[model samples]
Target: MLPRLNLRTSFQLAYRARFGWLATGSLVALLSTALLSAQFSGRQPATVALDTGLSVLRLLLSLVLVLMTQELLSREFDRRYFLNTLSYPHPRHSLLLGRFAAVAILTLGLLLLLAVALALLAWLIGQGYAQATPVALGSQYLVTIAFIGVDLLLLTAVASLLAVVASTPSFVLLGTFGFMLVARSFGAIVELLTRNTAVVTDAENYRSGIGLLGYLLPDLGALDVRMIALYGRMELLPADWPWLLLSCLVYTVGLLAMAVWALQRKHFA
Candidate 1:
């Protein structure tokens, strides 16, 4: 079923699949960030620019992931169109895997385009102000943006999984939104716990619970290195990039497998 998945057709469908709104949304986010940076009358224009740009990018991408997956999956399931598709010779897993690929490809393209636009906007804003610090266009900055793309990819996989298992679009949306918030804040939550010396009730157990959570949830904070780019602090990124990449890959694969399993057992009665 996986081998039979048509990549080209899926890519085309994804390109044409309600993508206009996503593109428009991304443009709005970009313009808003640029305008906010332009209006700021404070120190460190570069920091403000990068922070605003990245925050907008993350927000838009998160919406894209959740909404795209919900539309693609829920439209078929909710409307019972998936039954018609299953009437064909192809297996059910093909539909699930193919749609996921399509969404992933579309997401990657959107992320790259938005990242470039934001980078350019940041640069232009920096050039406009003589005293303001300009956003660095270094390799680290580009890499940081790439990491954000990876983060979106991981989140997309999770959203896809939820779309398959969830009963309705609203359920999928809420699950994905909650997952995004938890994943983004888990690192900070763990850090806060580590510093809370007042918790003298079984410190070892608390440490164990923190370690377990650290292993389970995605470390979205690790992928966020915008400060490194804004401040030209390359050392801020983890020393082992490969480890982070590996973790994301593992999580994506796990999510996809679960989505496929969920679809396999899904009844269309």
Candidate 2:
């Protein structure tokens, strides 16, 4: 239907405009970082390489998601190119959802490519050295990558929502990253405050305030499973996976719903 066609067109446009260079640059950066980290770290080279690669991959994917949102959504609106599409008989929410779907697919595709490259690089790095704690290249690594994808999709949902509500493309990029920083850091901040009550006199009040913010924001930090991939520590993952998956799903769907509602009411002049 219209959603399918819109998805195809949006994806094709994004592929042609951004995907090629972005993918190439991202792969190069990921592999280069892994190699350098492996070279520099005498002990546990593979673990360091994998850890650095995952961090770099997360950053690169976030940049890709934000840039794609800016180009595909905000820029289209800014240049009035979206007007022609909005004039179609299809519902506004369909168009918005279709475009968001394109972003999701493209981001996931990039994540997969970079993840494969990182895994290969990690394996190659491990082959030369036998460390005390070997890197987990099997299911654990795959699970880590899957969770990272979930995190990026959540970010994409944030971008999609901001794209609809914000006035400028810059705001969409800024707002998305800002939301990410807060979501990722708030949990750690609360935990640090909880552990070191002496660090702040009003720790209880501060914890309560941050706890309030936690309810509004997705706990992105909870989704980080790099340690499991790097060290094969599965002690906490079994109990945490279901809750993490559910929280991500709920937040993503809720954000997309809000985006659709906003797009439906948008007065595109």
Candidate 3:
């Protein structure tokens, strides 16, 4: 475990790929500034511009996290490099955690760098920007990144689990993408089910089934409370924070356990 932690920590600091993502998201800040000028007539257009840019950055970065995670941990190992790790005395859990940690770090760093770029843009644009305070804005951005990290930890754990269990890289990639779609669309799904009666059959049973799924699936969208992070309090109510943090931790551990079990009997074709 300690070795895995060390491995994860070391890999997390290596930002080569992550920096490229940061550069990409920075482009959103540039385009968003122009968009905001046309869309926002408010006195706080600067705030609107920054938030819009951050939103775009957050979205693209999330997708980047999923793609990069699948490529880094799943695709390579699925292609057989996993044998290198298997040859060692290392525990499977360590490998799982190490993989998750590396991806989470990459995601967090990309978001942070994008946040910095957006803040700098706000500073340089001065009229509407005069109201924009970089320190406060940066803190808000950090909080959003923190929120992304919590779920990124859980999601990567699950994705790695899928990879361990899957027969091929294609299967792992498809499964991860499917899970991401479900996790992200659950809200709209529930809303659609509630509003339209034809989509689901056996109303009572359907509701019960979806309810069960809701309890099982992670509430990833809850982490996108960007406005809450940007302009409101970062502190969660004592009761709330612990439950949320625990859910993520438990989900992460559960997925890791599943991954280890699957890998135990795994054999390449």
TM-score top scorer? 2
lDDT of each residue in 1-269, candidate 3, tens digit only: 66656465436534434646555655665566535662563555555666676667655665666666666667556567667655677666666667667777666776666666776665555343445432245566666667767766777776778767766666665776677667767755676677786886876567666667678787666566566444545553233655776777888888888888886766665
Query: After superposition, which runs of candidate 1 have C-alpha atoms over 4 Å from their true positions?
Result: 1-17, 130-133, 196-211
TM-score of candidate 1 to 2 decimals: 0.87
- Candidate 2 is scored at a TM of 0.96
Off by over 4 Å in 2: none
Q: Which candidate ranks first by lDDT, i.e. highest?
A: 2
CA RMSD (A), model 2: 1.3
Every candidate's lDDT? 0.77, 0.89, 0.63
Higher TM-score: candidate 2 or 3? 2
What ranges in model 3 sit over 4 Å off? Answer: 1-43, 122-141, 187-209, 230-241
Q: What is the lDDT, from 0 to 100, of the residue 169 in candidate 1?
A: 85
What digit string (tens of lDDT, one per residue) describes model 2 on residues 118-139? 9998888888999999999898
Error of 3 at 110 (Å): 2.0
